[model samples]
Target: MNKKTLLFTALLVFGILQSGYTPPEEGMFPLSELHKLDLKKAGLKIDQKEIYNPNGTSLVDALVNVGGCTGSFISNEGLIITNHHCAFSAVQLASTPENDYLNKGLVAKSKEEEIEAKGLTCRITDSYEDVSNRVLGAVAQITDPSSRLQLINNTMKNIVNEAEQKDPTIKAEVSEMFIGKTYVLFRYKTILDVRLVYVPNRQIGEFGGETDNWVWPRHTGDFSFMRAYVSKDGKPTKYSKDNVPYTPKKFLKVNANGTDEEDFVFILGYPGRTFRHRPSEFITYQQKFVLPYTSELYDFQNQTMENAGKKDKRIEIKLATRIKRNANVMKNYRGKLQGLRGIDLIGQKKQEDAALAEFINNNVAEKAKYGNLMKDIDELYKVINGDANRDLWLSQIYNSTSLLAVSRNINNFKTALDAQPAAQKQGFFDQNINQVKQALSNSYSSFELDVDKTILKRMLNDAAAFSPQQKVNAVNKITSKGSNSAALIDQFIKHTFELSKLKNQDYVLNILLKNPKSISAYQDALLQLEQDLNKQIAALKPEKDRREGLLNKLMGDYVNVKEKFLKKDFIPDANSTLRLTYGYVRGYWPADATYMKPYTTIKGIIEKGATGNPDFGYPETIKTLWNAKDFGPFAKKDLNDVPVSFLYNMDTTGGNSGSPIMNANGELIGVNFDRAYGATINDYAWNESYSRSIGVDIRYVLWVATKIDKADFLIKEIGIKL
Candidate 1:
């Protein structure tokens, strides 16, 4: 009962909390809790230490955080496997009309043929340490919530800065595993140069497109391969022709035998975020506002991109990645919205919240400490919900995928440059000029003026229609009441783009070299608009900070009291940290009278493609190979064909995409990609019956790699000899 002890050690000792429950729940269990679970009893043929040995490298050493998604090393030469979509941006960036790697797919047989994945970096977890005491202790004497939160943030940043300064190739992040309750500092080996090694054509990689995305009983070959490289001297550096492949401490062995129904399976990867520990008020806000709003917003952006892509092949290629990304999240949000309602999450949570209240009231000291906690949280969310519309609109306008979003960023930088005193301004410019150039470089590489104008106009029109209470002043300034504001928005957008120097990167950089007054005076319609709206946006921030700070402090104490009241500590929520979640390879009834099998095969792919819908279409080579029955050892005898994908009830979220699913002996069975649509509600609550994740079978991966794509070297490199 030593509450002050480190969370990792405490949770390990307590063995998953409740008196009756010795095993952790069906969710992402942190590394420390791994020893408590009986892997052998759960059909694991190998010792648990093989997956994660904190004292040294284990299977966890092979895992890589590829951009936002996860990947794993499968070859001693750092041949990494991940989701195709995870590598889609890099492919898109490298593709050109003359040599369109995306459309035809890139199969770099030799190291010299590998293309640099622009701006794509891979990070491996080096180590982590608990820093909760230091973080919370720094704010102990501060009574003001805002100041307390500020001090806590500063402490975390200082810790990360200190850890990072020790080595140039290592960066550290302080994750708040349980908001206010637990914090851990994770250090990662930063590999800056990653290269795209192999990928199937768009037809095979994104087989069903949005139609089959996030749905179960799927046959999408959503997998790809990449490689990590370092300087010849074994040091990470920027992409260079002289670089060599990285040799990992551990790599997963590809077991194409695949898994049978009810076989034990586990996944170790970085899951992004979850809110299972959130209050009913938070659930209510997500159900009512966040999901629906984001779904519609992303849908609109997808439609806009589709409309633009219809013009040409080059444009289509350029827009493909954006469309896939927007539509993927767009559909996911819609599914989550349906799930949130299906579960009646808000109602269920309220009941538990009431029980919590009753529990607090029953105890004298608990009542004194947590009497106003629920009420305070509810009030905080009330303010947040009320302003959600205004904030959402502003967020879109200032942070869209268009160049105008870049303009807002550059404009803000310029404004900050202008605000500095004349003496200090030169130093500020010298320090931040590279940041400005980097933003321009990243955004303008894919900038489109027509797209920006259309997106900005629509965003403004939407903002102009806000209710009187939430009216946007900057939007209202250009349009009159009782009239069509569409024309006004278009006009404003036209003028802004015409006058914005943000488009002229060289000109802006030259302007930045001058005095602070020069930077201010060089402003145009776009910068001025951002400035006006930011005044309103900035004005709202203090209140948000005050409310958020209070919640942070209160939630910390609330977790302790709640743990005490429940007589068990709830498993921690996912916060983009490494975790292990396991479940058997079994199917579930998606609905009444509908039982989904755990596996999908290549026949399903050809069957669906026969319909002739573009999404279902695949390369003719696949059909020819299937017709000829040209298969290899990867084929399952019972299925009489290669298994395409399978579903398991593994608890996962967005960042888990590209995670390698392992069999009992830690052999790679598949790469975890999508979750069943029913599992969309997983962020708020995970019902074991509904939370099933889909993965591309390792058999299918080698089948396509060896048979169709003729990547024989890959088979030899992985040592499978398929």
Candidate 2:
């Protein structure tokens, strides 16, 4: 036998160290398998059927994917509850200097008072079916790696297309589970006419700001309310004043009694990606290169926006959503990196690989078919990661400035003009000219040349410092006009923005409308820069594509064989699919000998009050209530205080924000918003000992609505008997 055969045989021989598995599997499992999980043993007081049922109305009927986060119907009239941050973009969009809803809270006194939330949609899963066998069977005959992937994708596309043909209003998608070893088809009922109902001030919703995000013992309310409207016939429709409130078949009852420590809890939401089963080589590359670089880039972008906003107030509102998104990812990447180091994830992955090799030894068929999977995957990582730095640098350049993006778009427009036949060129130009004009108009709305120039210089410096010598020479050639590095960069920035007609939307639109035959009419310095970067990327493309294809194939094979032979129940990594994860309301120690409680109270808010900063500036309305000790019916008698926020040990990630946290009786208890910093790595590895998800207590949400905001009609609409 050859060397590869010897390694395979060795792993097969050591596969079986033990027969059984450990308790508490660490993934978001499919909702169809609720009966298989021992929920009762973990303190659940209700039957599994109450939580999920395919043929009847159940809790799933109440759940919704709001925007990208999770939410649920809390009232029969389509009252939806999600995280306040999830609704922040809508709040910012609807606000103005005179009616700044973001600073003061938003509440609609009557149905007619509610304003439309443009570009917002809510999706609910109508049904899901396992189609794994059909998918795998169709692709079984293809041996070539790329061909197999193409065939699988084509098959899934056909299935979705056929499903959508039957009902134009419904959306269908095929999601993979177990790393393509299993597949599920989900059908969704989409509601388009969503409206803003209520949102707290920035002081209450984003109480901790960036400083206290992803930390436990939190006091942020972090909750918001919205309503879904449909046509009079109860069908999905666009934003029309004639639309009526949508009455869902099922909605959750808000339980103001709240939860105690160790009580049963579960979350239903659309979770984003998690790579717990990724190989060690990939993890090492991320820890060393990707996370660190991206974190710093995020910081540069945020600072540029902040500095620019100080000079222009209009830019602040226009860029608020972008800033919030960048900040969230910035902090999240930093937390993930720290958590990776804290837990030694790379080392742990190496250990798991050894055990997996041993497990493979027990199955002779798997040994023969999948013996070289991990070895091949690890080898491909070295080849793929070789050009990662160049690719990342180019990505940063393209995204860092609006002018560069516009230049690239204009270049593409010119290319399109050349590619079309003379007879059809006019038609094509007429079709695409307005799109370019619209893009230019939108880009200039938030454009700040100073901010863009600052970011451009930073990216140029970093790219020059990190790129290979050949690429560095190309950059040097571009900057050779000026005497020093700073002077050269400033010269480049000034030349690009000054000579470009693209800065004025009307000028670009007029030029495009006239249909210039050459790049001379619209050419700018950024176009030259784009041309240079494109050449560098093209030179590196062949090897990158080859290595990436091989790695993808190897991973698919490994997952397939592992699923067939592994003794434990296989749960797939999350792919922004609807999933259910159950756990208990609990807390833990951040370090040795320091136990943290699961829940926080109004007392913590009082202690954090009136720091004069927006994050901790407690509103006077709530302050008076606290000073008078006017604990409403929403306060918990057992704790003798009103609950603010609580923690639980459930598995979740980014898209899980605003998911409804429910108790055993299928009642809404709170809203899942953040996770403890220690738990950020739960996306990679769930450490039951330390990982925890944080949520705002539901009673606090009720208190704010009924007392602070005095939204009594809205409260009555939700049937909350306060």
Candidate 3:
């Protein structure tokens, strides 16, 4: 076998082993089968009889179409509430370094004081009508892939255009699922005027630090506040001092006294994405190869950046956020790998594959069309396994640095364009020149350069034996001190500048002037590196196809494997639209010797405090709360001395963040923040036996707001009714 083929085989073997399955048992879900029970039936819940729906709100009312985690009004006036992290970028952009709003947090003292964020918008008004027949009628008989894709896109575009024309204020988007089996056209009324309302300091918001990202038994006050603004006439408008505070028809009231175990809860937000429908082989590939490689890349970046951060305080501050973000993702991927191992995912997948194969055998036409597609997918896995390591190295090094190359290339394009036709030249300059400048202006600084170089060197060294091209280029560029570096960069800048000038566009000039060749080089290098990596990936296709076919055959053979053994129960994710997952609030043991209890109190913060770590340090106010024998009604146990943390088995994911975890009677208990370690893989497949949701008691938010921040007015506005 070639090196790529060998690598593919090795990854397949590793995946099977990591998933805790023997060869024959690979790809089998011993616990349950597909289609035996309805996921909607298992997961959905509605409060139709109630005056208001507690399980979920309308997608329109919640403003689900808005940018990450923003909401809108059911009433004529707009009012929005979203997570703090979701609004961080807008906050950062609006605040100066001197102000550092993120550090101190921000609260609009009144409607007049609220700051309008630039380019900030919240959209609503999606209208979905079934046009399945209209879309598929013409192409129902077409078998060509390109034709099908084009047909789908054309249909979607037409729908979106029609929707946009009906309401000029509305933005439209089209989503396709099940390989065009379903299409949804979403129309949204854009609310461009938004203002900051309230935010808690990083200390309170991200309490657990790197130690408690995805794990439950948790305490993190991950919440933020924002309100919508409208024109004087009460219609959505651009930022203006004249705009009035929007009054929402219905907004969730703050329930100070939180709920206990088995209470119903729900969340509404724009969840980014999930890979629930990915093929079993793809899942296995990610578990064994992709995730591990990516984790290693993050670790390398973290260490390199952290080391640099220590030298310069500013660097430290800048990289601190990046490190934290990367660390969170790294922790998630690690937990995901562990979850895959613990669940024997490969074994279950194999069983499902067998059943699928048997089904295909029974259906001749289905077998002929889908059989090759399955084979191709398996080949894709093998290719992925073969290229995993190179892909990681390139991603960390060349891919990350490709911006530099792109800048250079853009400059070259400008130079070449001078001789081209006027119309084409004007178009090119108008479009490309401005973008180049923006990229350069935002390029990583010199402090970051050292860190990037360190990672690049490490990655190049790893690939030295396998691929000499990168190492050769690195040596030629750095050691030889090639004059072409600066000259080429200058040429790139000049070309872009000239292009911008020719186009007579200020925006074009701004972009070209800001982005230098170094940044462009980084971007170009990434593309080339990816191309090389793909060559390696392409080599493992044949063997991969065979393995995939085998797995499919196995699934078909054991079609009813899961239904025959495991109990018929499964739930879908908490879509912002509506969902209900009923389970008792209980403590869970993640590992053999590690037990995560049901709740964490304020005292736990004091106990876990490290004076040196700003993230973990207790504020003076919290210390006072501890010093005083002031255990309020919400305090549990005689352990005012003991800090509290809670864990419960409730289904939740990204959208569930900031959801109200309520009691059986629908009283607010806690704010959902994250999932326990065992549940991180719930994104892939939920295991009711172990997966749990972690939430911060609503009482904590009250305590922080009243005692720490002393924001009495804001607290009162939340309708605390205390």
Instruction: Name the best candidate (by TM-score).
Output: 1
lDDT (Cα, tens digit) per residue for candidate 1, span 523-606: 567766777787897888777678778889878877788789789877789988898998878678888988888888888989
lDDT of 2 by residue, 453-558 (tens): 7888888876666645335444676566765766777777787778876666666667544774644355567777877776667776655545544555677676
Better of 1 and 2 by lDDT: 1
Which lDDT values do the candidates have, in the order given?
0.84, 0.79, 0.55
Model 2 regions more than 4 Å off: 1-23, 141-144, 358-364, 408-410, 422-446, 469-477, 480-486, 505-521, 531-545, 561-566, 610-614
Give candidate 1's root-mean-square deviation (CA, Å).
6.2
- List candidate 1 segments past 4 Å from native: 1-24, 167-169, 419-432, 480-484, 498-521
Question: Model 2, poorest ten-residue lDDT window?
Answer: 13-22
TM-score-best of 2 and 3: 2
What tens digits encode model 3's per-residue C-alpha lDDT throughout 172-218?
77654223444455655566788777777877777777776785645
Candidate order by TM-score, decreasing, is 1, 2, 3
lDDT score, residue 148, model 2?
Answer: 69
Clashing pairs in 1: none
User: For all the candidates, what are their Cα RMSDs to the real structure?
Assistant: 6.2, 8.0, 11.0
C-alpha-based local distance difference test score of model 3: 0.55
